[model samples]
Target: MIRFENVSVTYDGAYEPAVQDIDFTVPEGELTLLVGPSGTGKSTVLGAVSGLVPHFTGGTLRGRVTVAGRDTRTHKPRELADVVGTVGQDPLSHFVTDTVEDELAYGMESLGLAPDVMRRRVEETLDLLGLNELRDRPIATLSGGQQQRVAIGSVLTPHPKVLVLDEPTSALDPAAAEEVLAVLQRLVHDLGTTVLMAEHRLERVVHYADRVVLLPSSGARPVLGTPPEVMAVSPVYPPVVDLGRLAGWSPLPLTIRDARRSAGELRERLADIAPVNGRLPHGDTSPRKDPNPRPEVPAPRRFLRRRTTRTAPDTSTPHPAAAVTALAVHRDRVEALRHVELTVTPGETVALMGRNGAGKSTLLAALVGLVEPTRGSVRVGGAVPHRAAPRDLVQRVGLVPQEPRDLLYADTVAAECAAADRDAGAAEGSCRALVSELLPGVGDDTHPRDLSEGQRLALALAVVLTARPPLLLLDEPTRGLDYAAKARLVSILRALAAEGHAIVLATHDVELAAEIAHRVVVLADGEVVADGPTADVVVASPSFAPQVTKVLAPQRWLTVSQVREALSS
Candidate 1:
């Protein structure tokens, strides 16, 4: 259904072609996954299929690209709208209407479908994507995940033969991502639709793909094969594959079930060693002690001693300098947050997690002065965030928002870093140095707009970190990052935390939360439903557990490194 023959794309001022000599064929009714490291032209390939490469993006395409037998070279995106459906990374940019129902119908209206057919398709899409509860809600009010589903539903309503998606589940929680993937599976199996998707979170979608397209670094020729065949050499891969690699499994397992079937001996080996939790460094071989450590004496003796001794100086006391009390925020009569209270001492890392529309973003915004609290108070570093001046706020708190584009405005990477250094009164190249540390391959001369989603996020984070604020706020910081990039970020955040920076991140990436966060706070319906140590919260919630934890069940393992460490020890 989709074919590319020696296709190459080069932007106007690019030093090299974004994608060079890529030849691949995606059969009808098959799901093809496009994957590579950051800035390796996954998005560029998707654009080529929809004719967006040269038609709208102003890039030069060098070979033949066809969708459903129609050459994209001769036909513009609009000309092939009936046969191809494309959804990009940014969902908000795709919406042309205010309400969910209207947004879903806008594409069909543009296609000039018969009213009866359009109506039936719209309803079917609404049911298929579980958007019935939000049919009349304003698109602006929906969370990022909801917006993503709407963006996909809008395209699916057109009943196109080929669907091209970029990072479709980046913003969704695990359950919601599964729902979206299930819909895609149905389209491929039941309706004979073709799916071509590029995603960074391979753990969620790799097992569902019928075939895999691997793009090597530096515009190298693409490789195509089955999931295990391609994943063996892919630089970025899911945790199951990582586990398979660590265990020397003959054929890598892409899903937890397969991994589990071969993990009986591995599980028995790790049963004796405790699971490592946080930023455990290399050469640190000591087994992680239990969070609630007990004395060597018997339980009754320890309980009697503790009962006699004044309950050992409550370790849970909040930092007097930075604490929130009765915080509440209301937007458009909907309570984004209500009666919430949180506190962070210096050098603490907190992860805020929940389903979409669960007030995670609202809480992060309140910390950085983006959204004002409706009632109660929020204090960070002894000052109210909403009332602080720009210069004062920069030193107290810095937020890397979900959309990194919101923080970037300069033309080139050098200029953006320079502006950040100027704004924060840092050394001349401090921001640039941090950018290099976070994203080494991105050149200073490259335009910020030309960077990949992961690179853009790294740039934005570097810009924010230049100030070295006492409190750091990040919302979904790992949306598009590969495992390697995420590891770099984890090290960076761990270093910052050690340097007395308080970090708060609101994210749907469970593996990330498992790896870095010292505390996990789960919010639901504008209220704090669960708040505790990371292990307690995530281990109890099945949807929020990491892949390794799922495979090593009833144990508190969180990452592949932890499992590897236990076996090595």
Candidate 2:
């Protein structure tokens, strides 16, 4: 059990306290969820519990904090190592070993556990994490998801009573994230270990949480309650929750299975009303009211979206593929993207999804000539990447990287847009208009990276669109976004596809793939394992399936909106 008695934390930096006069208690063996928008002190609370608050982080802590009845102020992280285990947003920051096996054993060795005990725990944890196959693999070779599991396994080997995770699944692909989450669930359900986790992707994990703690950013204090109690009152929720609100169902269903049943009842009761057509007319239910002094924690949402200017293209005609061919790439070692055949006509959105290090980034780089493949050829607009100068590719192919900081460093957003246009020989006036349309919040003089990650991605996208690139390659475009930001980003991507721009969105979000992508290409170990429509690809990989699939139309649905539609229909 972890208890905070009037605990407030203030950092040395200028400004207000990170956490103010907070009082809360997490009972032992309960799965508690800590949720709030970015910079909301969720991580601060975790640090307090882990003995890093005033110790490692050098923060001022008022009042008392105790774990399992032991005062935390007296115990530093190293001192409390036997009681609590913690993981952070980025795994690379905490890794202390060179290989997966060595990584797992490092923590136990710190505790001075006997060799036999350590070996048994190591073997058990590796098997439990489904990482036995990668036991000897170098930590650097593992995907983001795999590395995170190894991190978790390392901590669990010591058998701490409390586990704290800060967005453990944020960087992972949907399938691998689910695998890691399942282990966490098992730990809580089977072992009764206390789990406190803060995450942005609530839709993926909210349904499974035993308790919900919502922290409003305006220092409005937190509200702790059950999942349904919190979600029913949540100002911003996922599509299913949104449906429950708009449809006015009592005891709102957090899962689609329950939503489906309630929806059927509503349909029967409202049979006399205008026959339901999945989507209501121009206006459905009134928008949610946010007159409260503090806004409820809106669901983890996106930063922003970019747009391209041009009368939206009409994608009514599907272009026939000239032919499917193999693209070979050689980079020191042969990372074969075997017979990588893809079929995309104008107007199709194809999503490339896989765990980190699965070659999604490599594939994107290959198409643009940043990396040359020894075996296959990349033909864009019926020409090769090097076939044109960087300027020519700017006019024909657009690429947005995962880290928005990668290409943006200009003094102003307008300058960045103008630079891309000048290189592509596009009209400066046209570029400015396109940038404004794509990023409404940003001004001409705004620093590109100064905006949020979502905004930067949108800005980069706008700059690329300004070039009128026929083929657009976006790598993990939604990497650090929340629910609303991701929704808007996909909306923009969808609109672009509707306008006939050939788009390849490389992402780890299965929900996004289900919602926007016409097709999904699954890459594993640097090779395409499945390529087809979103529905087909989801069917082929059950773990990669989105939550909506398990909820409404267990087999056919991929996105939450689709699940809601099927339920009402």
Candidate 3:
């Protein structure tokens, strides 16, 4: 249904083409996954299919892209809207209506569909994506993941033959991601719909793809094959594939079930050894021990203990870097958070995890003073976050919000780093150095807006880390990061923890939490549901467990690094 013939795209900038000689054919009713590292022109390819590459993005297209018998070059996006539905990386930029129901119906209205047909499709999409409860909520008031669902539903309501999605599940929790993927699966299988999706989180969608298109790097020719064939030599792959490679499996596994089936012998080999609790440096052969040890208390009991003991103070106990006691936050008459309790000490790494609207971001907002608590207290470095002075707060805490662009407001990358250094009172080159370490190829002269989502996230993280605040909070830190970039981030955050910085990151990437988080704190419906050691909490939960944990279950291995360490020893 989709064909790219000798395709190449180059923007107005004086540099190499974003993509070159990209030729591929996606059969009708099949799901094709575009996989690559950051800045590899995956988004550009998607744009070309939707007739947005040169038409709207001001780029030069060298070859033809045909979708559903119509050439994209001849038909603009609006003209092709009847057969094609495209959802870009940022969902907030895609909405044209105020409420969820209206957003879902907007596309059909544009298509001039009958009102009754539009209403029926809208209701079906709402139920399919589990957005029925949020149908009346304002698009602006919904969480990032919720907005993403609304964006997807909007496109879906039109019942297009072809769907182009960029990072469709990046903002969703595991269950919600599964729901979205399942919806796509139903479309491809039952309805004969064609899908071309580009995503960084391969762990979530690799198994669902009917075929895989691997883009090695920027301006490189593409490699197309089956999921296993592409993953065999692909630079980027999920943990299960990595684990299969480490254990010398015949064919790399894409799903947890396949990995588990092939892990019988490997499990026997690792049966005598216990996995490490946290990440270990490469080539480190030291004895595996829990880096951040905790008492053997159950999660529920531990939460209750902390709640009951909050009223009494121990003078000898060192002050926590940040603490939230019975915190509650209300937004638009909806309780975003309620009775939430959390504490972070120096050198501790805590991961806040939950569903799409589960109050994780709200709690982070409370910590960084972005949201005022409706009830209870939020103290950072011995001062209430909402009441702390700006200068004092800068030194005490820093936040990298979910939307990385919100923290960036400079014309160039160098200027943004310089501004960050100045605002943090740090050395002139400190922020730039952090950026170089996190994202090496990013040019100093490049505008922050020109960078890819992963690059922008790296820049934002560098800006925050320049301050060297005692406490750091990150929301969805790995949203746009590939495995290599995520590894670099994990190493940097580990160094910061070693330097006595407390870190709290809200994320849906369970693999990231397994790699760096010393403890995992789960929230649901604006309250803490589980709080305990990383292994204990993640292993027990079905929705939040990483691929490694699920594959090596009955054993408490949380990451491939830990499994590698155990096998080596």
- Candidate 3 lDDT (Cα, whole model)? 0.86
In what order do the candidates fall by lDDT, top score first?
Answer: 3, 1, 2
lDDT of 3 by residue, 477-556 (tens): 88878898887677777766654678899999999888888789999999999998787898899999889888988877
Best by lDDT: 3
**Prediction 2 global C-alpha lDDT:** 0.71
For each candidate, the alpha-carbon lDDT, in order, equals 0.84, 0.71, 0.86
For model 1, residues 1-569, the per-residue Cα lDDT tens digits are 99999998999987799899899999999999999887788899999889888899996899899888889888999998999998999999899999999999998899788999988998999999889989999999988888999999999999889999999999998888999999999999999999999999999999999999999886668999999999999999999899999988878899999998988888888777775444422122375444511111111222122222111212233443257789999988688999999987666678999998899999888988888989999998789989999888897889999999999999899999999999988878878877876777778888888787888998999899788777889999998887778877787776666545678999999988877787889999889999887778888888998898888887778788777766776
Per-residue lDDT, model 3, residue 427, is 72
In candidate 1, which residue pairs clash? Answer: none
Question: 188-280, model 2: which lDDT tens digit per residue?
Answer: 888888999987777667877899887777887787899888887654466667657766877877776787787665445433422111211
Badly placed stretches (over 4 Å) of model 1 are 276-321, 441-445
On TM-score, the leading prediction is 3
Q: All candidates' TM-scores?
A: 0.92, 0.76, 0.93
Q: Tell me, what's the RMSD of every candidate?
A: 7.6, 7.6, 6.6
Sort order, TM-score high to low: 3, 1, 2
